[model samples]
Target: MSRIVVIGGTGYAGSHIAREAVSRGHEVTVISRQAPDAPLDGAQYVQGSVLDLDALGDVFDGADAVVSALSPRGDMENEVIGALRGLIKRLAGTPSRLGVVGGAGGSLVAPGGPRLFDQGFPEEYKHEAQVGIDSLELLQQTDDLEWFFIHPAEVFGPWVEGERTGRYRDGGDVLVRDADGNSTISGADFAIAVVDEIEQPKHRNDRFAVGY
Candidate 1:
């Protein structure tokens, strides 16, 4: 089994990812400043902050992949980018892959055209969306790093936590939407996509979108 570590494993997205990886029999380690309300049975949880990656000690050692499910909100609104920069540096020459879970704000509404963010995104979410956009740009500039960024559907969040259908589609840099213009995916299915990529990666040094 691959050893996987999630930086914000106590959060909504990170927790789902940790659960999925562990269910798949992967050795999973979760690191977060806060403890999970209900920890997964098969996952290892560690208290740590992504802002201080250096102080995390050997938490990432021998990991097959490290996913940053951290969000730029609350006290962390201004810290995600800086922490990501440090993370990239640490995994720069290593064999472990770095995967970032970003918002759909950066995804193109249409190929070679306007981004979802530029199309008048909600004011309240603008800041967090901008951080995701910036994170994508940061990864793109890292030529020597083995990294991949994933943008979830526009309606993804804990409030809309749907069931796992064991199905999802990759939009490859473009936002995914159905016929009625609904763009969404269940948290569990999204986690499935994440772990599937971890096991057999396809979007190396690239960004992709996942949706129903």
Candidate 2:
């Protein structure tokens, strides 16, 4: 089983992913500003801040893969991409694979042009949402790094907990939409997709979007 490190594992999306990874028998370690309210069965929770470079590296030690589910929020919140800059540097020369969670707005809607956020996305989400977009850009420019970026469709969060039918559509660059022209997915299904990538690596050094 892989020893996976999940940053921001206490967040809504991160928690779901941590749960799925543990259910699959992987040794999962969750690093968050605070431990999850109820830790997953097979996972270890570490209460820490991602902005602490040395402490973050300790979490990555001996890790087979690293998944970043970090998002910026509130007044004192650390900048998502900024914090990752240090973490990525610390992971250099390691055999670990990296996967980062991105937002729908960050997913490309066109080639070398507009992102999903540019297409009339709400201003309220621009701050935290743009962090994901910038993080994806940062990952793309770092050609030397081994990383995978996963973007969830328009529908994401605790409310959309659908069953794990083990089926979903994958898209490159653009967001995937359903018949109703709405691209969305339950967080549970999103977690399934994340763990699936852990077990079977795909879209390395590239970004992928998933939806119903």
Candidate 3:
């Protein structure tokens, strides 16, 4: 079984990922500043902050894959880039693959043109979106790191939390939309794609988009 480590695992997206990984028989470790309110059956929850470089840097040594699901909000607003840069340094040259769960703001609404963040994205979320955009740029330039980033559908978050259907589509480098032009994916189903990538190793050194 793969040894998967998920940073920010107690959070909405991270917890779903950790749950899926555990269900797949992988040895899963969840890292967050606080323990989960209700931990998963087969996952191990570790209390720690991603900002704790010295401590967090040591958690991924033997992991098969490390997924980062950190959100750029609250006290972490405008600070996720630093944590990600730290992870890039710490994970470079390691056997583990690094996976980043990015926001849809960085995804192209239509390929080869303006990004979603540039297309009149909500100002309230601009700061968080900027971090995601910057993080994708940072990952693209890291030639030494075995990294893959996943941008979830546009209408994602707890407010619209959907159910798992064990299904999703991957739109590489662009946003995935339905016939109605709606881009959305259930968190559980999105987690399936994340864990599937971890187990199967597709999209190496690149990013992929996920949606229904």
Candidate closest to the true structure, highest TM-score: 1
Best model number under lDDT: 1
Runs in model 1 deviating more than 4 A are none
Q: How close is candidate 3 to the true structure, as a TM-score?
A: 0.97
Q: Across residues 165-203, which tens digit of lDDT does each residue of candidate 3 receive? A: 999999998899999999999999999999999888889
lDDT of 1: 0.92
Per-prediction TM-score, please?
0.98, 0.93, 0.97
- lDDT (Cα, tens digit) per residue for candidate 1, span 41-135: 98998998977877889998899899999999889999999999999998888889999999999999988858999998999999999999999
Which ten-residue region of model 3 has the weakest summed lDDT?
Answer: 50-59
How would the candidate models be sorted by TM-score, starting from the highest? 1, 3, 2
Scored against the true structure, residue 102 in model 2 reaches a CA lDDT of: 86
- Candidate 2 at 138: error in angstroms? 1.0
How many residue pairs clash in model 1?
0
Selected candidate, larger TM-score, 1 vs 3: 1
lDDT of 1 at 116: 95
User: Model 2: per-residue lDDT, tens digit, 1-212?
Assistant: 99999988988889888888998899999998875677788889888887786765467888888899987777424478778887788777788888999888888775675788888989988887888878888887775568999989887877776666767788877788887888778778888999888888888888889998
What lDDT does model 2 reach? 0.83
Cα deviation at 33, candidate 3, in Å, is: 0.3
RMSD of each: 0.8, 1.8, 1.1
